[model samples]
Target: MFNINYKSQHPIYEQIIDQTVLFLMEGVLQGGDKLPSVRELATSLGVNPNTVQKAYGELERRGYTENIVGKGTFISSSHQVEKDLAHQFKESLKEIFYEMSRVGFNSDYIQQIVISVLKEEEYVTDTKS
Candidate 1:
């Protein structure tokens, strides 16, 4: 299931893409699991079919999903999926770091913030478990 936030600055397709990747990373969507058809998802989300198609297209490009002729799109099973996701995360982090650096934030400060956030999240997760 997808949730769209109309107020978010992120485009609908990008939001879908991000949520799909998060689902895959969290193991909520596993290998060979079928994705909702574009039309079905669009209707459910009240978005254009083209937007859903764009998200699926990006997922396929990133090796997260595969489209089988006559069979709906399914999550990829290759270990490469994890590798690709890790690489994407690194790239995104690098971009964030660069932006912060441009704004005069030092590496140490960024690292401290990151570590603190990670620790807080870990603590919360541990408590929940």
Candidate 2:
């Protein structure tokens, strides 16, 4: 369902996750769709099956997918996907914020860093709110 670049600094599993998420957001892969099995995808991409498995595991963990025993993985239904992902991103941010906090960065520092990063993006404007 996605292409892989072996030479990219990003990890293979993460690349898979990113491409899959992009596909979902871009309407290239629809909800309720079945993704290739781990073996099929790994063989096609010429990567270790564990890599594909890791990607799929992350996708499942992130609320983008659900795996049914004996049936493989499927994207969440369109109706429920938005709601599921809404909280998921917040949960991810919480984890990141917690990690950054442990390193002595408080919420204000984190907000400034986020705003700075947003300001650096050409398409972003007025990130302060």
Candidate 3:
């Protein structure tokens, strides 16, 4: 289930990769889960086949998926944490926090905002991140 947003500044291939990672993180997709063919996904998302291929290529390079000849692509059997994605996510958060600080948002205020969002999203349970 890919959600493509043409109006967003983000590229479609990156969105596909992001959503795939989210699915893995949320346990909606697990080790050995089969992914649609690039052609199928491209047709479904109304994107170029090369776009889907690029996304899948990046995912494989990050060790998130495996492509076996004739069998098709699948989620990695080990399903280990994607280090590149984690690093990039942390770096992006750092940039956001820096921007927030420049705008007068203190650490405590930012923490509160994070806590509120986590709680509202049902990701909090009396424990802080």
Candidate 4:
């Protein structure tokens, strides 16, 4: 469920963190879903177990996952987890918008693009429904 690009500029741990969060947000991973053990994930990804452990630690710190002494790690169901994820997404979007503005993108153009994308997604969802 996760892919690692050794040549990518992004660190392996960061990639793991991002993928886990994306999975959670997309509902591919729901609350109480067991995450792969560090050893299993490390072996599958061909990375050091330490890296996976670090990613899991970060997820736990961010309230995305919780560890049970004997049951392995599972996704958290706390409402705060969703709120935190939303806030993180908003901050990332803000950074992207600021970068675009720095490169001469105007607010009107940005709004139009965003609205267009949203409308297209809504259309797709409606058709699927």
Candidate 5:
């Protein structure tokens, strides 16, 4: 369900975390679905089982998943994924805005850019329909 890029600056476990989140956000992995075994996933991905275990541990800590002994890891349904996605988006936006400011972009220009993108997204959605 995920492809690892060895050349990427990010760690393998981090990539797993990212892809798992994306899968949940995309509805490719539903709540209550059991994730593959660590050994299984590690063998498939050609990474150490420790890596998958670490990723699973982090996911559980972050409330993205729950581990059931003797059963396995499953996606958590306690939290609304859409709400979580919005929160993540907001955090990412803040980081991007900070970087933009560091690069000399003014708040007004950033606001304009964001507004323009929203408009373009709306136009694209309209065209698709």
Candidate 6:
């Protein structure tokens, strides 16, 4: 299932990619799961088929999905904690750190913030169980 927001600043294809990643991260989509065809998703989202194609292309490029010649696009079997994802995560963190530094947040303060968030996450996980 896909959720599209027409008013969002991000492009439709990017939103689709982000949501697909979220789905994979949340276990809503599993390894080897087949994705809807581009035309079907485009019809559901009321967007051009090319937009969904673009998103699927990016997903494959990012190692999230695999496209078979005649069958269909399927979720990557080794979806959990792949090298591509690890690199992407690091890049995202680097961007965040750079922006925080640009806004006058020192490295020590950033570390503290990250540690606090980690503690809070642990607390939440403990309570959930």
Against the reference, the lDDT scores of all candidates come to: 0.89, 0.87, 0.89, 0.90, 0.90, 0.86
| lDDT digits (tens) for residues 86-112 of candidate 2 | 666788889999999999998899999
Tens digits of per-residue lDDT, candidate 4, 41-71, equal 9999999999999999999998999999888
- RMSD to native, candidate 5: 4.8
| lDDT digits (tens) for residues 10-123 of candidate 3 | 999999999999898678888889999999999999999999999999998988999999999999976255564577679888999999999999999999888898889988
Reference-based TM-score, model 4: 0.72
TM-score of 2: 0.63
Ordered list by TM-score, greatest first: 4, 5, 1, 6, 3, 2
lDDT value, candidate 5, whole model: 0.90
Of the candidates numbered 4 and 5, which has the greater TM-score value? Answer: 4
Model 1 segments beyond 4 Å from truth?
A: 88-129
lDDT of 6 by residue, 73-123 (tens): 999987343665677779999999999999999998998887778778885
- lDDT score of model 3? 0.89
Candidate 1 residue lDDT tens string, 1-129: 778997899999999989988898788998999999999999999999999999999999988899998999999998878897798889999999999999999998988777777778885343211
**Model 4 weakest lDDT span, ten residues long:** 120-129
**Model 5: lDDT of residue 88:** 87
lDDT of 5 by residue, 19-42 (tens): 999998788998899999999999
Measured against the true structure, the TM-scores of the candidates, in listed sequence, are: 0.68, 0.63, 0.66, 0.72, 0.70, 0.66
Which of the predicted structures, 3 or 5, would earn the higher lDDT when compared with the native? 5
Clash counts for the predictions, in order: 0, 0, 0, 0, 0, 0
**Winner on TM-score (1 vs 2):** 1
Clashes of 1: 0
